[model samples]
Target: MDVSQRLSFFAALFKVHENPTTGMWLLYITIVLLSILVFKLGFAKKLPIIKSAVIYTFLILGCTVLTFLGVFLPVAEGLVVAALILIIYKIRLHQEKKEQAKAE
Candidate 1:
């Protein structure tokens, strides 16, 4: 509509990390990458380091796009959700490990 609104829209689309909330996004991404590495390392897999790195790169870009779409009321909310997901994943994994130990 107006020039200012147009500019803001474009900024949000391209400037994800410019917002402080993007820190949460980065944290979630880091967690995902680290988890992948841990899994591969545990199994003695070759560790597709290069491929996994690229995958994370694309995922970050995708999240930025989704953030711009107003998908989560200023994007920070999405970051919080991502963090929660990571927490849940870690908790579940810990429980599973405990169960396996008992069985063993």
Candidate 2:
């Protein structure tokens, strides 16, 4: 890639300038999995099996677009940070609830 294209951290890391197919696939999978993790940790709610299936379907489809941007941006990195924050929040919330229950 040219100097400008290499500005994408993951693109350079994945050697996209050398191998486009492999790099693109790696970026796509990374983005999709991270997107699902972020969704489950921060936004998902209980639903019927079919409803959940539909939601996942759309989520997977949505990740396709994200994959393109991910190659040129920190999309996966951002999602990772978001997922970590949500996970920490959930852990703290759980602990608070446990402490309250014991006090009660």
- Per-residue CA lDDT of model 2 for 39-84, tens digit only, reads 9998899999999999999999999998788777888789888989
- What TM-score does structure 2 among the candidates reach? 0.88
> Model 2, which residues run further than 4 Å from truth?
1-7
What is the number of residue pairs that collide in model 2? Answer: 0
Instruction: Give each model's whole-structure lDDT.
Output: 0.51, 0.85
Q: Candidate 1: which stretches are off by over 4 Å?
A: 1-47, 70-74
Q: Give the winner by lDDT.
A: 2
Could you tell me which residue pairs clash in candidate 1?
none
The best candidate in terms of TM-score: 2
Q: For candidate 1, what's the RMSD?
A: 8.0
Error of 1 at 27 (Å): 13
**Clashes per candidate (backbone, < 3 Å):** 0, 0
What are the models' TM-scores? 0.41, 0.88
RMSD of each: 8.0, 1.8
Give the range where candidate 1 is weakest over 10 consecutive residues by summed lDDT: 2-11
In model 1, state the lDDT of residue 98.
100
